[model samples]
Target: MTDRDADAALDRAADEALALFADDRRSSGDRRESHVRRPQRASDVAETVRWNVADWAAADWGGPVPQDAHAADSVSNGASNSSASDSPADGSSKGSSFNDELFNSDPFSEAASADRPAPDDRSRQPDSSPEPNRPPEPNQTTEPDQPADVPNEAPEARAHATPWRAARTAAARAAQPLPSVVRPLGEALGQTLAEPLAALTDLPSFDTSAMDGWAVAGPGPWRLPSKDATPEGTGTSTRTSTGTGTGILAGHAEAAPLSDGDAVRIATGARVPPGATAVLRSEHGKVRGEGRELYASRHITQGQDIRPRGQECRRGDALLPAGALVTPVVLGLAAAAGYDELTVTSRPRVEVLVLGDELLRAGLPHDGRIRDALGPLLGPWLRALGADVVATRHVGDDPEALHTAVSASTADVVVTTGGTAAGPVDHVHPTLRRLGAEQLVDGVQVRPGHPMLLARLAPGRYLVGLPGNPLAAVSGLLTLAEPLLRTLSARPAPPPYRARLTEAVQGHPVDTRLIPVVYQHGDRACPLRFHGPAMLRGIAAADALAVVPPGGADQGAEAEILDLPWTADGIGISADTATGTITGTGGTP
Candidate 1:
């Protein structure tokens, strides 16, 4: 059958089963009792109920059963007693209330089960002997004694019973589509390439000297006559030397242009005059008659000390591809290539709003008011990412003020710190919803920044809600802010490096933990002391954030976390073997 038909069939079957159960509960007066509890063996019940609506959903849809499906099954099967036992006086007349709750609790369970593979037909059913009078024993064998050669439990069965696989299967089945791409580079960094730039001229356009010396003739055996040599001797000896130094040669008596045997003094980076082919250093040459007369101690060849034109880059070549980031090095290269201005991607504008009435601007805390940490914290971080902070406003916890601030800002990204929780005072979440923002990550399974929210305000505009706590705000920025910046800038996602943990860390099994850490070497990373959302001091002191992965319940487990450097510019980790010093490169590592 088609997918739709299969899904409808599964839904109908599940509804019928639920309807049958509801009818049985209504007809029977024993409302407090569990469903199908008779002399029926637990194994028989388990086998009969194993492939519930979720299993059918798995078979119909395509993947393994979802976690929520199991949760829904547990709740649906367990809630029978509570719902059935309620009397008319107790206000339990709403039969659909229990179904509604179960349905709402897990919307995808039925769909997930329909997607899963069908159960094996070879499996035999267990005997149905009721054990309602006796308590269920843990890990009890219910199957009849079989042949010694035939194994009761298959290895595959044992493997399929793991929770991790179930969770992974559920996660895979419930995967959502990736968000649409927007102007990624423009939002984060203010700089963008106007067009693809090609080199107009070669680097070091002309051949230049690299040393302070005399540019002379070819490699040689030089015979220098005395400066006071006889006129006849001068002519004969000079003639002999002239024939040997046919090319540009050293001067016999004084440093002069090559008339026959001449050498001109040239400094480093000085242009080599015509006829000059090699360089003879002053230190290596002997000055016999005052400083004018010189003799070469070592031989040299042509073009030995010259830096050739176009050695680094050629003219008319592609210097930087279009859409490449215009960094300091790129700017320098462009300038060196004789370009005055570079056309780049436009910088994305960002506006920050700090919301809360309890936030104190500065000075000692008065009464119950705390100092505003977001203004001092996020502003510089945003700027470092190349975003132009158009405005920063501190608004009270009033939803109207927040709406006003957000509406007034013309920035591409509007970041609001505080009031994201479910408390009565929390208003950011509701305000964002009212503004028609599409939530990306409603609430990440993370500590510190658990309340952090990501939403798209417009095509290119984004609204990021940060937790009110100082550390939580920072964590939120690292997790979402940095990624948003990169997306806005159109920069590629950075690759991660492996680092050994210096100390053991413990965390909740459900939440992903972000710990402040300092990378000692390029490979060794250690967590900083005193790290938490409320602790601003610890965040300020941290060099990089070490991300502890999800499921960190065990101590001493190695974590693979994104390394957020202190500076938001880029990854900065420098280890000097000579000095044994570690430095961050100021970006995501």
Candidate 2:
């Protein structure tokens, strides 16, 4: 069918579908009203409409609709709503872009044409003025490390401050006096080395054969003697019945020196004799004269297939510098270098306190109480970030209990979830004042976790307050705890890397937004949905957190990425197929 004919058929089908919803419609004259009315009984009209749209999209557009694309029905609804609003009182149709809009919007945004106008044409014009209360474009150029903008009518106390500066200040002030520990090699996987790894002895201490071969004294085509009639008391060594050279095993010690025309059958790694000039591989030599005699068939080159002493390293040579991470390969290398133990930086001890009266430890939400997601997640995450999580305590919103818990903890850092705000039930700030603690960071200019704070309780003790929301708490952990633990454990900061955003990220007008993103296999990053401050869906599946500036980042704009402690190394390469877990490396959510 022709394109125009197909458009007319679609319009007719949409009208029929709308007619079916007449019983649920509002009064006829409310042009701008678009929502379906509440039905007295359960109905399937919405489902029918969605299926119809999906069918039409597939058949007319020559593309299959993504089964999980929930936005398809919404696009159809928008077009229907536009048609309804454009209808005249006399029942005449007004020209509209409904068909054009529907045909152009692709379910996967990457496949959509940039030049194609949006369903709402106003969005396509850069010069179009935004609504007065609407946020500005996220790609606005801003100075480095500047605070995000505050709303014009916002109170002075609500000024959005720089988060990076706050993190730096907290880290600089977070110091611990714990002594280094000598740990067995097997126990030093995640720990940073406190001293250089030096070789105890020279590698390959003696000259050896590099391959299974014959150690020869000189030129080839040499003959071996027959064992026929030599005097029994003669001053000559015994030989094999075939008169081949005596075979030398790898660990044979006290091997006699070779004369100018002699050859010794030597294995790989076997020590060469004092007077041996070269080693000829087994494949290069031949036996002749039946079983009584043998001859070296190939010409011999001096010093071939011989491993000289101390080829890898000399005794006392430094192998690994201090502060190196003791990974599996490092462990093997240390063992080869004769180190039984490693001196590693001490892990900073941290105690966690989860505060909230309306939190349940397990099960689905009931009676307005939510499951305690942070309690189960934070401990392991902190350990992954190099903190020794000593204990985790769940204390309800009781100020006295909170105060006691904070006072009794002997850990280097106390991480408290919730109770940092100024609400009546939020007792963290007031309790800090009562205990005469100094607040290092009051608030950060980051979204979802802006209420996070850091305080110093004593010379070597610290308190970090994280927001109660599951995802917000994660932001706080990375923003405050990561740096603090890194400093306390004396681990060096990782080098910075940035990824170009594959899609535009909406930025807060004044606050830097820490967006949950998965690095695509293409090496760019794409933002995930469901990343609201209270939601954990995005962060749970993210490979890294994109540090968006106040104005946000545009498609293809480079943004700094904060790697997650557990999965950063395998971001785009690792896959957990059993559970179908995506590692934020461009996999689908």
Candidate 3:
């Protein structure tokens, strides 16, 4: 069959299907009213028309329908008016003996021609009727039965199971360009630094006294004769005199520059007088002779309890370089170093798109709907990873709506929480293709998030496709979101840790594994045995996600694991040493 023919058929089928469904709703409403009132016979005309149109639509483009190159140009006209009595459902039940004849002698069979035009033909206009509310059609083909919601399950899961590979692939595919370097410090909290930072000034720029004491000018071991000292002794006399006098004074009076034997008192932060090199505590000194005499119990060292100029840090030194994650401590240090502001990278903005028709915002399903947990689940997770969510929206399983939402977002990263499967309503993959996005990783080998897709829309712009399931969405966010953020920030991927598996883990032989687990010791993390992507309780209780090798291994086997670090500050392997576990020291075990 031609692409043109297929396109025409699809267009007609879609239009007819939409109209038929609308009429069906009207008929159904009429029947309900009839039941409420007196019993009345309702014409089945609308039902037959709805059934035929729906059946035709499902057969044309619903699930895995092979494309014909020529069907694309077959026709641009709308559906033709047919007699409502010719319902496809009636034909199936009453004409069972003629089923083969109808199937073999189908008039639309020739519609699958090879001379189809491209999908973007200006002559084609989409059917305007809104999608009908209907249950998914049951699989009627001869193909093997697969999970209705997730069809490409096993292979995609296996592809994304490797964290390192997935991380690298995601990073490579992330198109968000590195932002300009001149962003404000407030906005750069989570961004990577474009350049290194140097200290602007020396901490403690001037010599300051650490304690309130007399700044003396004399050699060590200078003797203060007890006979002439005050009752409080030499140290007390010195302290008292210095407190009273401006500098050093004579004859226990307030004056400047005391005589050799005279003592002056001083307060905390008071500058020491010239010729004074040591501080003797008042408690250790003795005073005698009506406060005229003072004596020291011990010798004092020079520069005692004094902060020298440029002690903590020197001017122009590299206090903190660019690309370093700024913590509160870092901010404090920078402030102390006399920097009013800093030049840092800018944090990437993200937009979360939740896609599905069966998903409900809240409450129980009145029809066949289910409450959506992806939005609530992913918003916090992305925020925890340091990505700023500028906006979040829920798009029902409509391809055009999904396209519009994604196209309108100016965020660096766009995450779609569902609609990645091949089901009729699964529109993410096709919508992305329509948007001119370059697919980096179409599918990964991993559990729960195998259908995840990573793509680049433009420079500094990324799109990550997540499965419709809540757990799958989370897994995709973790596996793909991490690297995408890093790439935008220009940060390197964190290294993996070689952890000893405390419990045996079973996994597919061909796929890499990601098992959510908890670390016991500070450095040595052991895998928590129980896990399920769909079960939020177990994942919530987990401390880390341990990566098991492709094949299953026994307990005590050392496997590379990615540390979730939800509660920790840094990433990388925790080094287990003989003394203590070391982390964030740039060492690996």
Which model scores highest in lDDT? 2
Worst 10-residue lDDT window, candidate 3:
32-41
- Residues 225-275, candidate 3: write the lDDT tens digits: 233334222233333442232222222322244345455455555544444
Clashes of each: 42, 2, 72
What candidate 3 gets wrong by more than 4 Å, as runs, is 1-167, 170-173, 181-187, 211-216, 219-276, 279-299, 360-371, 570-589
Query: Against the true structure, what is every candidate's RMSD?
Result: 18.7, 13.8, 21.4
For model 1, the superposed segments whose C-alpha errors exceed 4 Å read 1-195, 219-261, 553-558, 566-589
Candidate 1 structure quality by residue, lDDT tens digits, 1-589: 8645554554444444444433443353111112221112323332333344332222111223333334345543553433323333112245646423221211233333353232332123333463446543332233321111112112222222223223222322222212322233322123545567788898777655677655665443333334434222112222222222112122232222333355544456655554556667656766544434557777677676767778888988888776566665776777788777766555557778777777776687777676766776676676555555666677776777777777766778888887766556678777878889876665555555666767777666778888777777876776677667665655444566556666544343335567666556666666654454566654455566666653332224455656554343442122223312112111111
**Residue 206 of model 1, lDDT score:** 64
Candidate 2 lDDT, 376-462, residue by residue in tens: 787778777776777777887788888888998899999988877666578898889989998788778777677788889998899
Error of 2 at 554 (Å): 1.0
TM-score per candidate, in order?
Answer: 0.59, 0.66, 0.60
**TM value for model 3:** 0.60
Residue 281, model 2: lDDT of 82
